[model samples]
Target: MEKKCVNEKKCGSCKYLHMTYKEQLKKKEEFVKHELEKCPELKGHFKPIIGMENPWNYRNKVTAVFDRDRKGNPISGVYQEGTHRVIPVEKCLIEDELADKIIGTIRGMLRSFKIKVYDEDTGYGLLRYVLVRRGFATGEVMVVLVTASPIFPSKRNFTNALLKAHPEITTVVQNVNNRTDSLILGDKQQILYGKGYIEDILCGCRFRISPASFYQINPVQTEKLYSKAVELAGLSGKETVIDAYCGIGTIGLIASKHAKNVISVELNPDAVRDAIVNAKVNGIKNVRFYKADAGRFLTQMAEEGAKADVLLMDPPRNGSSEEFLRSAALLGPGKIVYISCNPVSLGRDLGVLKKLGYRAEECWMVDMFPWTAHVETAVLLVRKP
Candidate 1:
């Protein structure tokens, strides 16, 4: 029997809570298989879907928006899907227990510190959103208070109160978002406590996770996913690997162990910085980090006559762009490992890559996100002879 979620409709986080856990995984696996079947090169190549033992509370990061209710009381939670109305979640089954408690505690301190929730209409308030990131392996936590402006009234007292309540919190940061736009994080940030970032171990590598670093939410499955991706690359300790869209160099660093060298490219300069630091911290000498557009970098590599034996790409939910596929085709890597969050976009991109002399070999579904419509699919593409 499926466990009914209390905040399913209002929270808008889990889309498949009504179905049993088994049904959820099966549905996701079938969905990926169905999408990949459209491409002739991907037919009958999907491996068994990897399901989680205990999928609840797997998310390491939680983002809560602050707003006012109809009665003008401060509220915090996720917006109701596509709107600005905060859902006011007291307890979420999927969220980390301590992180939710901290957010709830901060919500209570709003009145004590004279903090006003930001208003999207008037844009006159201070508090905007609360972001909490936890290190699954290290038991360290980072709290980021998103504010409309740098001026936080009684900021010292507020942070002290939060730390006193949650002694396990490692860091507290205040990020200012003066714009009226929908971005959750701002440019300017100040550390109110501890280091501005937390650390976590994934696949035997230590990674520094900042308030904005792109660490995987599901740490356990992340190890499995990266391991599988590296396995599919079939490195012989002599191959040159290119990690594209490499946020924090998670995949690139992991691949460094098996490959001779790794070149990781990311668009975000901040993530690239963290990736560089992560490589040094992990004592990995063979991986190089580059802050550039992955497509343009691959194109440049092609123009320079540099050859990559394997191209490991973990694109965003929207998947890789056609330009990237063309660039990848020009580079002519022997094997291309694609990690995708959206199977539809993966299939669409695979079609484009097929025209680039790449044949899809094996696809596997790894359920990093449970009770949700989202699934991670890893596919290996071998260049056709």
Candidate 2:
């Protein structure tokens, strides 16, 4: 099929926009297969999961950086690749309609308040970016205003104006990002209106997400991914399961129905607290959350003769670290479900597991991030005698 870039050379989000969806999927599948081939032991077991039909407009949330135009009017959108030039986005195809509306409202609010755009050189600006997250099931919305400093009186008035304007918003948070160079949230957060956090339901469990917490951006695909992970774990009523990197304990909570005991390990204390609250609200006592580094906890467990029948991992985009993978392999769980967003790193880590005498029993590909070059994969590895 012929391929063309919609916003060719303008939008930096998709470098492969010039390629057709079919061609993009094909390229991604080939890339995954080749990476797996790097480990001869995984050559026969590697499988390609099918890509999604509608890849565009799949993202549930979008974080748009703010800048000012030549006229000194605030421009709200993403920056051009490798440069700080602001690209005003009238309609982002990747986000939902609510996200677009939130962006439009924020732009209007900035204009109405005459807010100054933060300059990278001077490091002065009231507004930095607007983040919007939508709940698929409840139609609830959360608007997060990221700024270089605390909201001024005028900006606070602007936030009040927004809440009065849009009642759909369930949570409005102002994140203070004073650091000169960083993409993360600042040391403090002030709740401007309503609840400080929003609720998202996954696999029949409700999870409260703060601005800094990490949750899946794509709700529909995440549900499918979590369901698949639970299935691959093959949870039995008598089995003990360990969910590593259990962000908010979504996987562990879902798997609790089938497993007798679930131990969820997360490095972030805030996430761990949220996980515990989620478990309590859901009337689930079988799940326990530990606020510790995943790799270190697994290594300690291995040294202490602690073992789990099933081990489930949903690591970050970089995939699991070498130490974590080696520790997991040494634990010698009956089954290991490794979920990853980056195929290259997943393949690399799978090679390490192969040397530890584990074989990839099954592989599934999920088009979690469609339209772009990213894909989510899940592999179930079993220890071989």
Clashing pairs in 2: none
lDDT of 1 by residue, 163-239 (tens): 99999999999999998778889989999999899999999999998887798999989999999999999999999
Total clashing residue pairs per candidate? 0, 0
TM-score of 2: 0.93
Which residue runs does candidate 2 get wrong by more than 4 Å? 1-8, 39-48
Residues 1-385, candidate 2: write the lDDT tens digits.
4345445476777766767777777777777777777556565665666666566666767788888888878787777777778788867666787788878888887766877778887887788888888777777788888888885657568877887778788888888888887484776788888788778898899887777777888888888889998998888799889999998888899999999999999998878888999999899999989999999999999888887889999988888888888888777788999999988898888888888888887877777776677888888888888
Each prediction's RMSD to truth: 1.1, 2.2
| CA lDDT scores, all candidates in order | 0.90, 0.81
What count of clashes does model 1 give? Answer: 0
**Candidate with maximal TM-score:** 1
